[model samples]
Target: MADKSSSNAYWKANIRMIQLFLVIWFVVSFGFGIILRPMLSGIAVGGTDLGFWFAQQGSILVFLVLIFVYAWRMNRLDKEHGVEE
Candidate 1:
């Protein structure tokens, strides 16, 4: 029972982290890239609107950063939960 509760807590934390990252991904890739693009147009990047930059490259860069962040965070979480590999 003890082990089961610990495992459940670990999984819950893991899922919560994933959900947060996914929301950020969606906002960056879709919201900034399309829906909120017009609002961001006033901001320029490399002679173009910020939205264009996000649609073309910024989102990909953000995704890469998020991947690393997730890895680093999850590794720390694993260590905290005594499940590091």
Candidate 2:
């Protein structure tokens, strides 16, 4: 219910937040899980190598955390933009 410019700004901010979250998710799930596996092979996590752990579990955990974080952030953004219900 704000002005047109305010509405545009809200959408822009929302898109930016989505983009950032996607990038982080990609890095965690792809970068750490696959691309950087070799570099992380030496480290141990929960009885497996760091890379394997990331590929199997860490990425999933990170994704779930990101989901919660995104929801929380979006709520704040909605309030800021006067779009909350």
Candidate 3:
């Protein structure tokens, strides 16, 4: 039915968005903070190396921003799919 297809589409889009955000978070928190720390050591932020900054603070800030961004985006997505509250 049309409703079922629409629901599937909505879920697909939502999952895609979540995957994208998760990749971003992983790259920031794990890649930069650990795996790529040596490469980023030359860069300074808030009196520490970029990697440390990401490990200690930058990733958290990015995650908080992502939370707000995800909420706003989901609201828009819901409205687009006629599922808004």
Candidate 4:
């Protein structure tokens, strides 16, 4: 049987990672793409405002990157917690 404390620690760590990724997703998709759009308007991106690029493409790219980052981090965490598959 797995040690209860170790299992708890692993779960906590997993949750933390998930939270971090969610925050990043929110920031890129909403903060940069919408709320801060006007501020980014002056910046050029593919002949349009930076905000447009973010809303149309940047957020998706960032999300993809975050997915990989989360996976990589979780893999390491799993190994550290002796829960790797």
Candidate 5:
């Protein structure tokens, strides 16, 4: 046997990636959602403030993008590290 314990490592790395992405998602959504909205009040896109869009929609879009990106990256990492199924 050549030893095959890479799966566990890949799983852990994937989990770490997910956690990091989630934390960023939370900060962008909630932190910018309310707590920091005032500071960002001056930044406007069209007629809406940055934070306003973050709260109402931007965060959700970012989260979705993060998810797909995470998935794609994880797949690449796994393939590179010889851990994919």
Candidate 6:
């Protein structure tokens, strides 16, 4: 495309998406897995401590969703901005 603003729009959108996802990822893994885990120790998941579940399983699930969300959003944004190529 000859439009520079359109290219910038794509970068900005992707940047925001990546930043938000990383923050969420950090909060779930480091925060729930280690830092704030004690506060959640009383909770259980599949008969295990919630923090342990987060460390072992929940983070993986979140990462899956994050990847799918990024793909879907990128596809939509690409079409919206005529940058699918």
Question: Which candidate gets the maximum lDDT versus the true structure?
Answer: 1
Q: Candidate 1, after superposition: displacement of residue 80 in Å?
A: 1.0
Q: lDDT tens digits, residues 1-85, model 4?
A: 4677887999999999899899999989898899999988899987899889989999999999998999899889989888777
TM agreement with the true structure for every prediction: 0.91, 0.88, 0.91, 0.90, 0.76, 0.90
Off by over 4 Å in 6: none
lDDT of 1: 0.94
Superposed model 3: Cα runs more than 4 Å off:
none
Give the C-alpha lDDT of model 6: 0.91
9, model 6: CA deviation in Å? 1.6
lDDT of each: 0.94, 0.89, 0.92, 0.91, 0.84, 0.91
Against the correct fold, how does model 1 do in TM-score?
0.91
Which segments of model 2 are wrong by more than 4 Å? none
Candidate 5's displacement at residue 43, Å, is 1.4
Model 5 weakest 10-residue run by lDDT: 1-10
| lDDT string, candidate 3, 1-85, tens digits | 4487777899999999999999999999999999999999999887889999989888999999999999999999988888776
Candidate 6, residues 1-81: lDDT per residue as tens digits? 588899898889889999999999998999998899999989978888889998998989998999999899989998988
lDDT of 5 by residue, 17-85 (tens): 878998888899988988899999999966889899998888889888998898899889979777567
Candidate with better TM-score, 5 vs 6: 6
Candidate with better lDDT, 3 vs 6 = 3
What lDDT tens digits, residue by residue, belong to model 2 across residues 1-85?
Answer: 5577877898999999999999999988799899999898889887878888888888999999999999999899889988888
Scanning candidate 2 in windows of ten residues, the lowest lDDT window is 1-10
lDDT of 5: 0.84
